[model samples]
Structures are given as C-alpha cells and as structure tokens.
Target: MSELGKKIATRESYGNALVELGKEHEDLIVLDADLAGATKTGIFKKAFPERHWDIGIAEANMTGIAAGLATCGKVPFISSFAMFAAGRNYEQVRNSIGYPHLNVKIGATHAGISVGEDGATHQCLEDLALMRAIPGMVVLNPADDVEARAAVHAAYDHVGPVYLRFGRLAVPVFNDEATYRFEIGKGIVLKEGKDVSVFATGLCVNEAREAEKLLAADGIDAEIINIHTIKPLDEKLVLASAAKTGKVVTIEEHSVIGGLGSAVCDILSEKQPTKVMKIGINDVFGESGPALELIQKYGLDAQSIYEKVKAFVKQN
Candidate 1:
C-alpha cells in the first residue's frame, strides 16, 4: 500500500514516466488517437509538445504512423484506450508492428473490466490474448504504480514491438522501488507457501495478496506470484513453484478463456502436469456497474479467490 494510504492508478504512473523518459531519451516520440486526456498521455504531451503527435481518432492510422516513425530510428509510444489500440487496430498492429518487429511501444490503458461504467464496449478483456498471439510481441501487465513506472522504462529499453497494458482503476501500491526490481519475462514471488501457488497479473495481483492473507488465517499457506509479463512467461519460476505446491490457481481481471489462466495451463500441461483452477470472467461480457462491485460480482474479488482456492485445495 502507498505510504499516504491512497491507491494510484498505473495509467497515472505511465503518464508521469513518459514525461521523465522524454527528458532523457530525445528520440522518444508519443502518439495518441485523440485520447490523450483519457489515457493520461496528456501529461507527456504537455512536457514534449514537439515530440507528441495527436493523430485524431484514427487508431489504425496512428499505428501505421508509429510504425513509420519506428522505422526511422524513433522509439514511438502510442497511447489509446485498450479497445482502440489493441482491439480496433489489430490488423495494423499485426502487420505494421508485430510482423516487422518494429520498436514501437503500445501503451494500452483502460484494460480489463475495471473501466467502470464504460461497459463491454470500452472495457478490453481480450487484449492479452490478442497481443500474446502476435509473434515476437512482448506483453507486459503492471500490477502497481511502481511496476508501471518500471515497465515503461523496460519497454523503452527493449528493441522490439511491446504491448504495455494499464488499468483505469486505482489499485494498491504493493511494491517498493528500493527493494523491488522489475524485469521483463520474470515473475516475482510476493509470498511463499506450500499448499498451492496462486499466479496473478495486473489488477488481480493485489487481490491475490489479500487472498493470501485470508488463506493464512485458515491455516492454508498459499504462495502468491505476481506475473507481470504475460508473454515469454517466467517458466522456470512457475515450474519450480508448481513442482513444490502440486496445485495451481490463476487469477486475472480478463477472461479465463485465453488470458493468464490459459497461459499457465499450457505451461503446466506441457512441462509438469498439475491440477489448475482459474478464477476470472467465465466467457461473459461486462455490464455497466461500479468497478469494485463488478469485480465482486464476477468473482474476481479477494474473498471469491480465497473461496475458490479453498475448494480447489480440498478437492485436489
């Protein structure tokens, strides 16, 4: 949690990081499809007006422009809502960015079901699956403000097409910059236990931590792992934890169909077979409601995770 006892949205950290990065990297350019204010890219735009480009509301064109800028030795960070950046411009992103392996960073904000009152039209639940399917695309989902700030720097340092997912909701700041180190393709173990391993990403990571506490009270030691990177997952760490626990549980704000749950299942099934349980949206679209209430209704809350894990641990 933050020292001030207030939650901060990852998108806010991203906007602040971009301004700092702009001061250091002269070649860094930011592009937005007329959503600078909503996506928080307005902060970067204010800092670097000369380097920022507002390409109107055309997402596909904005992607192409970013790709062109990348080809000319410029590191372009394109910002938009997740639905527009990853959903509306999928084909352009696939061919213009992913296929060419361009050095473009897609800063997709308002991801998952946490975009309160926006309904399914604005909330993006399939971005992880969509981005993960692209070859050579590095997918990053930050769990807190600190991780989000670090992920922005990591994406800039990496020399390939990267998809950086951010959420609109303010989540708990669980990581300390002094001790916590963010690495691409690495999973951090927040807590260690013996009964079951809980793998989580993005907004669900904080909830998983709460679930860890609940499980501890019940004499169930649950190991909690924050999987910030969805692509090129930390297979070694996951396998090691699963080997010790023998049971696995995955939680994400996205759908269970092709999100973190699917990714973990694929790894466990291939390398070491383990009983796995998934807690997330069960192939249903989101409706307009309060973000916290929607999370509880969809069984993505900490209590729901604890109950599901208890059942899974008992059965397995």
Candidate 2:
C-alpha cells in the first residue's frame, strides 16, 4: 500500500477539472443553482466568468438551460448539491438531457450523509439510484481527488448525459496522480488478497483501504478494488474477483439499496452467485452532526468496516 497523501475533497477536484477542461474546450460552460461556492464550481466561475451561469435556486431550470446549451454544441456542466441536481431536477434531467441524449455533465456535490451538519434532507442517499435509472446516463462516483479530476475529463470527452458524483469532505489521496489512469467503466484493484474481495466507491474507498490494513493485522487477507463508475459497472472485473475469492463485500457512502452494493448484487446474482455483503447507510436517514462523527455513527468509518468484514470473513 502506498503512503496516504493530504486530504482533499473531491468537490474541489471537480472545480479544478472544469477550469482545466474549459481552457482546452472553449464550449465548456458551467451552470450552478445558487451553490457555486459550496459545490466548488465557484473556482471555475472565477476563471471563466462569462462561461458560468448562476441559475438562482432553480435546479430544474438550470438543468433545462444546460440541455438547451447541449443542443447548441456547447458542453455544459450543471453543478449543485446532489439532493437538488439529482433529486429536485430529476424530471428535467430525464426528459431534456437524458431523453435527448445531450452532451451535458451533471456535477452533483455533497452527496450521501457526508454532507454532515446539513442533515438528512440535504444529504442525498438516492442520487445514484435515481441517476442510474435514467436511460443513457453515465454515473460516476470517484474515490479521490485524482480519480475525481480524471473522471471530469472523461465525462467531458464522452458523448451523451453524464452524472458525476462528488463529496464535500476531504479524503485520503490514495492514487498517484503521475501514474493513475481513469477509465469510464473499469475497476482498479488496489490490493490483492485471497480471503475476500472488498469493492468500494466514493469516500468509502479510502475507509475500505484502511479497513484492509486492520484485516491484515488479524490475518485476513483481502482484495481491495475501486468501483468508481457505478452505472456502467465493471461487471467483468466484479465477477472475476468474486470468482477468485468466493466472498464479496461492497461499500459505498450512498444507500445500500440502489447504489454500488445493489449494482454489484444485480450482476453477481445473475452470473457468479457469490456470497455478498453490503456496507453503507442502511434504510435509515442521517442526522445533523460533525461529518466524521456521522460517518462513525452510521458504521461507515474504517474501524466499523474492519469489524464488519472481519466477522464476515470468519462467519462465511
């Protein structure tokens, strides 16, 4: 395992990536629903003021505007909290952007319970499930700063509607920016082990990595894989890992029902039929608290994952 680098939020990376892409692609424009600063799209707004639009608090209107921009051959990225971008503007996103198969990128930030003090209403646990249901929508939940920035570039290059999920909390920088490569629908195996395969996405990926170290201390060898792309899931890699280990565990910051865990189960139940375990926000809403404290309360911290996986390995 590589030494963990400084913690940086994926939302920050999303903002930086837009500026980088804006330089190369003049048609790239950013639209935010009165959350430019929080969503980090303000960074892009600063660099290219003319290309950025603040659509007030109207998320649906912003989505419609982005769809219109896509029709004119402009690559528009609509930014907002996940609750609004994916939840409040679902109809517009599905009809205007998704149905038309426009070249629009939806940058949804502050996803999951990690939205912290904002509480359950602001924290969106259903965005992944919602976006994944949309036809022709490419859903991406990057694990770290490097992957988040790379995913932004990939979304800009890919045609059709893309949903990019980002987190406000800073996480461990696991990937080396110099050598890391980000693909649209591929999984990266960070560590190899024979006991079990632990697949993780978003903020949970780094926590899973730390859990792996704890599992190692207890003589449980585990394979850690990063499933950044949730919609066009890397089924090939998923099945291969499950086949190798016969035990699978999926961890995500989103709800267990329609997020990475559910996606993995959908594929495995059909083909591999391996024993699978899901670690995430169960069927419960989150409460207002410190971000890290909320993570621990919800059993999403590194210690919690370690305990759960260790018991899982022992029992099954």
Candidate 3:
C-alpha cells in the first residue's frame, strides 16, 4: 500500500508521543507558546492539563521558562511554530539552553513551506539552518509519523538540548516498521543503490523516495537515505554513500544554505569528493498557496528532484 493511503502526519504522531511522555515522566513539562492546537501539543494539554503549560504567545519567554524548568530537573518539551521557536528563541536557545547544556526538548511544528496558506509570515523555510547552526542543539527532521513518534522518545532520552522540526501537513509514514529504529544521531538507509545518492530529511525524504522509484523506472539506481538527525550529522554513512555513488542530490524542505545540502557537501568535502545537486527552497521566502503547489514553486517537490536526478545521471 502507498504511504499516503495510510493517512498520518508526523505532527499528529508528536501529539500522541507527548501524551505518552507526560504519562512516563512526572518531570515532563509540556510548554507551548500559544500554538498548542496548531503545533499538536494540544493533545498533551488535553491529556495532562497540570503538566502542560500554555506560556502565552511569547516564544522567547517560553524558551527561558523551559530553561528554568530544565534547571529544576524537569524535561520541558516546548512547542510552537518553527519560525517562532527557531527565529525568536535563537539567542535563548544558544546561550541559556545550549550553553548551559540543558535537557530542553523543542518540538517545533509547522516547519518549512508546508505551512501552506500561511504565507511568508508563518512559513519557516530557514528554521532548520538556524537550529542546526547552534553548537549544542541536537537537530532533528523526522520523515513521517513513525519517525516523529520515535523522535519524541529519542529527544526525551537525550541528555542535552534537542530541536525537532515537523511539518504542518499530512504525509505517509516512510519508516520500515520491522527493521527501522530511531536513534538520536543515526541516519537510516532506506534504499540501496549506486547511481545517485539522495540524502534527505523531514517530509522531503518521502518525496525523495518517490523520486527514487521514478529514477529506477528510468534506468537509474538511486540510494534513498533518511537523514532524520541533522545536527550530529552522520558523516561516515553519508561519506560512504557519496563515495560509492559519486553523484548526490540532497533534498530538504528548508533553505539550501546551512541546512541539509550544506551539511552533505561538508561531509563530501572532508572525506570524499562527490558532485552534489542541492534540492530545496533556495534562499526564498515562501508564499501563500497549497502545500504541494508551494513545494513545486519553490523547487522542493518530488518532480524537481526527479528532474535534477535525471540531469545529474546524464552528467555524472
């Protein structure tokens, strides 16, 4: 069955995981910057009203409070829009939570241009780059519902600061239920091939897999890698894949700069030399539209990836 027929999104899975977290840890505190409903933290608030905190519409203050809660031995999973969480709480995340190395988990939803119809104001195409730039922050971009649920637990278990970015739209779960497992810093190799290595994160990973299928039909062998963890980048696996493929196409919903594209190129530059074609939102603010249309307009959709892979296979 196609994953889309399953009808589940990573954001909804996060809501389910937060409820489980509150049940498991009495020290678990759920905080939202007035976006609990939209960010899917409303499920946590509904399940555990006492443990869930509505910190108004202030993202910065929410970060500060999460830091304070962390200092008191509480695991604060803060929720909000990715733009507000990453752009607004950047300094607080860098100095207070990260510099102090606190166990503060940030579950920022509505990441990427997937914040459809919300336009440039609410859409966050650069949040991944911003969060990944932090020194001690553990950056995550789960591919779908299964990985999103796993990431919640993974973030809960990790000792220091963690940032998880999830989409506002529904997507099919790409995780292989039997053998797949989520690790804090480990990447998943979903499909094995040598023609082109497509390393992708978040919802884009699903698109990359779809693109891989199309590439295979066109007599191309593409490796589809689910790079769930972006901060502690899996350089060894990526370098090995790049070395084997010689040609790479990085897919992300966020900007190419300082995001997955840059990270992959960094790995290739150090351990191997691979020709990388970066596919993502290229330094452009997203406009209000349907999510799929916005994806195509921004050149971050599966078709764009297919074309890039086709062009790359011809050259390399």
lDDT of 1 at 237: 92
Say which candidate scores most in lDDT: 2
Whole-model Cα lDDT per candidate? 0.93, 0.94, 0.87
lDDT of 3 by residue, 1-316 (tens): 2243475767888899898878888999999988888888899989899998998988889899999989999999998888888888789888888889999999889988988999998888888788888788899999877788889999999999999998889988656555568998788888999888888999888888888888889999999999999989998888888889888888999888889999888878877888889888878788999988888888767788898889988993
Candidate 2's clash total is 0
Cα-based TM-score, every candidate? 0.98, 0.98, 0.96
Off by over 4 Å in 1: 1-5
| Span of ten consecutive residues with least summed lDDT in model 2 | 1-10
RMSD of 2: 1.7
Tens-place lDDT per residue, model 1, 1-316, is: 2343359999998999999899999999999999899889999989989998999999999999999999999999999999999999999999999999999999999998999899989888899999999999999999999999999999999999999999999988879877879999999999999999999999999999998899999999999999999998999999999999999999999989888999999999999999999888888889889999999999999999999998899893
Off by over 4 Å in 3: 1-4
What's the number of clashes in each of the models? Answer: 0, 0, 0
Candidate 2 per-residue lDDT over residues 25-110, each given as its tens digit: 89999999999999999999999999999999999999989999899989999999999999999999999999989999999999
